[model samples]
Target: MSQSPGILMMVIAFVLALGPLVFLHELGHYLAGRWFGVKAEVFSVGFGREIGGFTDKRGTRWKFGMLPLGGYVRFAGDMNPGSQPDPNWLALPAAERARTFQAKPLWQRAIIVAAGPIANFLVAIVILGAFAAAYGTITIPPVAGPIKAGTPAATAGLREGDRILSIGGREFDNFNDMAAFTSMRAGMRVEIDYVRDGQQARTETVIGQDVSKDRFGNEVRRGVLGIAAPAEIVRSTVPVWQAPIVGVERTFSLVGMMVDGLGQLIAGRVPVSELGGPMRIAKMSGESLSLGFESFVVFVALISINLGFINLLPVPMLDGGHLLFYAIEGVRRRPVEPQVMEWAFRGGLVAILALMVLVTFNDLGAFGVWRNLAGLIG
Candidate 1:
């Protein structure tokens, strides 16, 4: 673990890391809306009271806000910034209806809703592709070095020198991929395929959870297979033409890891306290910056993927929520009632707020705020 920077440095690092990614996400929605002939009322990089902005010729107001933690693109006829439909949209004259989001066909609407996450993925892929083209990747054979007694690997009959071939049918070309896959699957059963000497074998094992303190003293739960990688590592560089393909592979690997972690959290295998909010992100941003540019870029990619995935959750007040509603609309042959949308969005808002509070409390604890207060009382 590295020492976090000064408060000011951390703030700067957080803004630098999060702001652009948010802007890019909103940009995706804005562009898609424009392409589909839907009018955007505002393109904002944050929430709350507006700080500054200018309306474009197309009547889109581009602005910044006091809070830099999140952003949105308010399409025309949206009730608020959440993309909720406005009744006034339906009452508008026929000409005005042409540019409203609600007037668009279902498929076009789905595309606009999905574009934000797609943009984040695109950014990750491009950054990763650039890295691959520049430095290639360090490859390590997925050979087991040591097996800890009484652990999942030992119980599953894994031994030293067993070459890990795959997990859940996905083959690994590097130890790093295997490690990430295993770590994200705490308390989940996974099928492992490995080769020993002249024979290949398969085994089903329940991944074990290992609890450890993170750099900021927060309890972190990760899956452990109880096997270590061999000492040797190899750097394998691919041709420039292959960089993008390799980048896609790397991105998908991360996506799987995120999905597994979320599943573990939902299944109660990982505690909800493990959820980190803005302060944790800020600290990580500063620490990653200290590690050098390449590490920072990698961190950005992870966060980007996370942002994309989070938005796709089927909770209201998020893009995914809207998509869920659209899915029902597709099946029902009509929009969900506005009253239903309102209730769903309200519930989602409450859930999002509750999560924010939990993570913020965890962040304060991680930053030693409670300790400082105790010292003051003493």
Candidate 2:
């Protein structure tokens, strides 16, 4: 295995990669709020105590916080960074109320909230489009090469030159998609459909497992199909004008995969240990940086898509949570009772915190932090 990047390099890479993405996310909210004539009280990158900032002419205090995990934009009449309306919003002077976020129409509020995620998606599209324009899109045929004896594929009567059609009902456009689908399903039984010599066949087999160690000595496990097929490289030069279209298509494709992965996790088919947090991201960022500029850029685009997708989940204390409330208000033709909103936000906060703790614990285990500490103690 290759050596891991230095600790300092990992920290630097984490900051360099996540900082701009967070800023852009918050900027989307800020710009949309401003467009709706809502006054932004604070535009902050990161969380917790402010490190340094300056008040802009529009009274938006642009600041960096001590914790670099995430960020937010607090608009006028917001009770907190979560964008909850102030309880006393109606009591504000007429002029002040007009410039407050709560005073905006429901549709405008929804747009402002949704803009953050949309911005993230746009970032992914632009980066991917640039790559497609420069290097073209690549695709590989989903054909089995060599089936290892005694493995699941071999046991299921799979043979070389079989064209894979789908696994577990999910059709694949290419071999990469098939590989991705299998990699997350270690130890899970899956039905495979394929065409062999112009005849269709189906087989059920458990995905095989491969366990190894990264440079950091952390155990890595992945599902394999026991096929030793080298990916047939097929590159198509995308016209510069059509690059964005390719990017958009690929972006949606990735989102679909993510949805499937999420469903798998929820159904208990994928282990919770597979989930990760900031530390995992930092590790991957450093590793990608070590690989090359192109690898790092791709990593950034993937993370951007993740950030967008996650923020759109209808959980409280997030942009999606806010949008959810706006949606409710739109249907009801009035805001939800303040008490109900408060409890919902509280529940959302608890959920978000719990997720953070869970993913962080998973990260610690993945990095062998707990095991190393036990070694020191023992």
What's the count of clashing pairs in each model shown? 0, 0
**Candidate 1 stretches greater than 4 Å from native:** 148-157, 165-173, 185-193, 201-220, 232-234, 371-378
TM-score of each: 0.89, 0.95
- Error of model 2, residue 143, in angstroms: 1.2
lDDT of 1 by residue, 44-94 (tens): 899889999999899999999998889998888988645666867788889
Report the Cα lDDT for residue 367, model 2. 79
Report the lDDT tens digits of candidate 2 across residue range 71-98: 9988899886456678899989999999
Relative to the true structure, candidate 2 has a C-alpha RMSD (angstroms) of: 1.8
Error of 2 at 213 (Å): 3.0
- The C-alpha local distance difference test score for the whole of candidate 1 amounts to 0.87
lDDT of 1 at 340: 86
lDDT of 2: 0.89
